[model samples]
Target chain A: MYENKRLGLLYCLPFVIGVALFKLFPFAMSFALSFTQFDLIEPPKYIGLENYREMMTTDKLFPKSLGVTLMFVALTVPLRLAAALMVAQVLNFKLKGINFFRSAFYLPSILGGSIAVSILWRFVFAKNGLVNQAMTALGAEPIMWLGDENYSMWTIVTLNVWQFGSSMVIFLAALQNVPTSLYEAAAMDGAGKTTVFFRITVPLITPVIFFNLIMQTVHAFQEFNGPYMVTEGGPLHSTYLLSLYIYDQSFKLFNLGYGTALSWVLFALVATLSAVAFYSSKYWVYYAGEKERS
Target chain B: MMSSLIRSMVAMGVIALALGSTVVSGQELRFSWWGGGERHEAFLKAIKLFEAKNPGVKIKAEYTGFQGYQERLTTQIAGKSEPDIMQVNWAWVSAFSKSGDGFYDLRKSASVMKLNEFTDNDLALGTINGKLNAVPVGFAARMFFWNKGALDKAGVAIPKTWDEMFAAGKALRAKAGTKAYLIDGEGYDMILMSHAYVYQKYGTPYVDPKTGKIAMSAAALKEWASIYKRFQDEHVATPLPLRASLGGVEKPTEQQPDWVAGNWTGNYTWDSVIRLRGSTLPGKGSELDVGDFLTLPGAKNSGVFGRPVHMYAVSKRSKHPEIGAKFIDFMMTDPEAIRVLDLSRGIPSTAIAFKQLLKEDRLRPLEVKAYARIATLNRNNAITPPAAQFEHPRMQKFMREVFEQVGYGKINADEAAKMLNEQGSTILQRL
Candidate 1:
């Protein structure tokens, strides 16, 4: 037993080394950098709490960017997870070309971080673009989807939610694992489709939903490319997210110290939010073959 | 398994050593610049010519699109892995040349090349704190490019002053009936032109020399912002949404000489854009006429509307500072380099190269005209340096936002002015 445990650890050595080097080392370094004023050229100067203090008090754009990012996260996460669940439920139906539909829906998730999709997004939402042209064809006024501050955030949110395939696939797998006997017994009791879905299907998939919600929430908060490429945090800084702001400061303005500080703040916020989500999941999440120990 | 791993590691070490030796063996220089495909091709051709002349030096050309070049360059600099020869913008001079010894002092290197060959202003732009840090390749000034055919069709005369320009725009709009406007409502360039006009009228640049800060004169800000607001209100400029759809007048053909091809009027841009337009949109039935850089009426000196656009700076930590300085000198003075580069990097700054190109008839007509115009303007006026804080990306973002706000009519002139004062200072301080 001891030999087996040693072998297991030996086999996991590569992963352990990778985690230490790539993740832990960088995390610690970034934390250290947060305390210093480094421009990446001259030696880093230790200026304790200056970056954080400035960000908290003096940085006019920080609060605005933080608010915008939070607003985006708030709008996107629940909507995206719910949409994914709905689609997964539908895909779970014993329909023709199920494999094809699944693949087609899953394609966007695969292409989510790709440059091609972002370019396509730009074209789709650009003024006189596909969306506006469609609106015109429908005898409605063409909205300035990207150009107007009012509608630009929605454009980004829609882009985020549109790639719901990853969560959908997970939900689909979870639905397949859901016991067929429960649904059968419910049907025999003259339970309607809606009743079965709400009572049986939903409870069984709650764990997966919870998993997806946390992941998507974290992802939504770190949303950078959509806003960076499409609106460029513009139309009066409406789409400026914290990540984009950090990037601008570090790379564009060469303020590595302040950028690091902003990054740490973002990390803390995500960590706290994730903790809260995990804590809340205990109440709603349900796993198969588990008693109500709580 | 351990033996196999050892074998693989040995092989990897051998490969790494081989690659390192190969890189060290060659007189390799990594040259970086940001431009489009044509510019890349031209640069490659120039590199090939240089390599053929000096067989030992092998030039490795690196290029990127202009959008995020500065950011990428900064990262490379911070990482202590900057390219040997970099095409740096002039705005970066003050920031990059932080200390006197940060970049290669060109004056102390390369006896073959002489600095006296280039224009005084061009040479001066490269000099940070009396040390020649970089070499200027070209000069470009923001000016108006009018479509003669469109103006003729509209039967409107070119305006001499701001008020006249407004009246002409209104007349053109009235005549064309929503199909045309005098200029694109994209941000800042025209406003800068307007600022220059006011500066010429007042004989004070945007920055006050005495205070060593931005001369945000309330009157000047109000006048400039009000004029911009008025331009929007009069429909002389395209609405924000329309302008946004056009993608800043440079991207869409319908907005360019095509707008002229379709019978609209003039646009404002640096002169090189005219050459680009002429070549790209050949035989578009539109002729580009270089208009005078507008001066405010009754001005003491019509201040020259030019900035030191771009300079070639050696990295402070360059492994081969002498080699970098030599390359810059070659770029500035070499006849072969001059022929290969042509006016692609705007008009040549060197008087010898300028004369050589002029005699050879290699200089573009547009470039010649631009140089002449700049020279004429320079006789009476001095070049104004951009505000140091304004060089920051935050300031650019702030300006872009305020411009959008003003363009979209979200806030009036008063609100924009206030935001500019507050946000502009904040960005500066943050930097």
Candidate 2:
């Protein structure tokens, strides 16, 4: 038995070693890097909280990028959650061609980060692109969809929102798991369809909604491809998000230490936000045969 | 069993020694560059020829459009995995090859490379500190290029002077209506012109290198802003929003459809780049006319913007540095290599290559005429070295932002000048 246990340990060694080397080591190194001044070509020199101080004090683009990222999260998280829930509700019915609709809806999320889709998004928003061509055909002036600062972020937001299918799938699974007896009991109580939904369906699915909300919020905060590829953080940086800022600093400018510090701030922000979300879930979330926590 | 183990270890040592010998005997080089269709094809052919001539050596090519080449190259450099050979921009020398230690010093292999082919001034452009880091690819000077088809349709002849160019703007608008533009002068183009004007008037560097200060006065800035504002007010150039719509200032001039259609007709770019600019027009290559460098009537000098267009450098970390330097020498000075390259990478940098190209009649008429005009202006010695920080990315951002603010009416000429002064001082403190 001892020999068998040792054999099992040997079998698990590769994965254990990989996790420690690739993931844990990098995580620790990144945190350490936050306190240094590194320009990649030269060895890192320790500067202590200077990177943080500069980011908070003199870096002009930091606040703008943070604000942009926050705005994207505020806009995309709720919109995507609401969209997914609505589509999932519609998909929960015993309707014809429902699987087709489900797959069709989920396709965008699958194709969202692809280069081909990003190129298509550019063409769809370009000044002389398809949408502008359509406007001209309708006897309206063409709009600078991607060029105008006021509207460029909207193009990226719209592109990101179109990838709501993944959250919807999760919602759909949770909806199907919702008890039919609860609906029957609510109906027998002479509750209308709206009342039944509000009291029965929504209450039971609150936990899934909470899960999707937290996940989508985190994903939206870390979103890079849409703003990076579609609008390119341009038209005077109207859509410059935190991820693009970090990328430009670390990769393009080679300010690796500062970029790492900026990332930690972003990580802290996401963590606090997610923690708040979890704490709030106690008020509204429900689980089967269980009372709310405390 | 112990005897068998000893025998296996002896055999493994033999295999290791054989592998080490093979590694030393063969070399593979990686070369990277950015260009249009012509340069990519010509460069690939050159690589194939180089490989064929040198047995036991191979090369891997990496090329991309200019859009993200700098970012990608910088990333590779940061990762310490940059290619063995690279085509570097003139502005990047100080940033990447500071003191020439950042790249392989080609002077170390002087026997392979004929450095005397290039003039002392040309070599100086590629030198950082006392160490020669790179070889200048070609001589480049900015000149005005116009679409003859559009200018003729607007009943405007090619403008000969700055005043005539302003008049041509009016004539074009009068004949072709408000939508027609005399040129497309974005922030980069306008700021360069602004420096040219100031340099001509004051005979001073626009930005002092030692201090990073805006050497021009507020009155000089006002004069610069006046010309900038006049171009917009008179429809000599398209509006900022319109330029943004066409894909902002960074988009290649050749790729814009408006430029191809002769709507955004004229440009101020390096004379070497005119071939690519004209090739994009509806008339293939015949529509562009190489006009005079926009002049302020007998102002001291022409204020020509002259510099090396491109350069070739070897990686400091490259294992096969000697082989890479030999390849660069062949590309730059080998007559067969030069003929194969043609005018793909602009006119050759060396005097010998230029004479050879001229005698071969390989250059187009437009190129011949453009170089001739540049030659006349070079005699005046008005050309100045671009400010060390002038072409740096961050400084270019600051320069572009000033013009953009002016265009947006967020700040006037005097306020813009003050902002530049304050910002320039702050940036210099860090340097």
Per model, the share of native interface contacts recovered reads: 0.42, 0.33
List the RMSD of every prediction in angstroms: 3.0, 3.5
The global C-alpha lDDT for each of the candidates, from Candidate 1 onward, is 0.75, 0.81
* Candidate 1: tens digits of C-alpha lDDT, residues A224-275: 8888776777666788999999998888877888999999999999999999
User: Tens digits of per-residue lDDT for model 2 on A1-294?
Assistant: 876677677668779999999999988999999999886667789999999999999888899889888988888888888898889999999999999999999999999877678768877878888888999999999898776877887888888889999999999999999888888887888999889878888898999999898889889988988887787776677788999988877866657899999999999999999999899888888878895466
Residue A193 displacement in candidate 2 (angstroms): 4.6
Cα lDDT, model 2, residue B221: 68
Model 2: per-residue Cα lDDT at residue A45: 93
Question: Could you tell me the TM-score of candidate 1?
Answer: 0.92
Candidate 1 Cα misplacement greater than 4 A, ranges:
A1-18, B1-15, B209-211, B239-241, B245-264, B278-286, B301-304, B359-364, B418-431
lDDT of 1 by residue, B1-431 (tens): 55565588789999999999999777788889988776787788878877787778877888998888998888787777888889988767667666656677777774745777876777877786888888877777777767676677788887767777789888987897776877652455646655665576666654453443556666666565676667767866555555554333124333443364544466666665566655533344236677776666687655555666578887776666666777776776788877877776777677888887898898666668877887766664555555655555666666666766777777777887777676666556545
Q: What DockQ do you compute for every candidate structure?
A: 0.42, 0.42
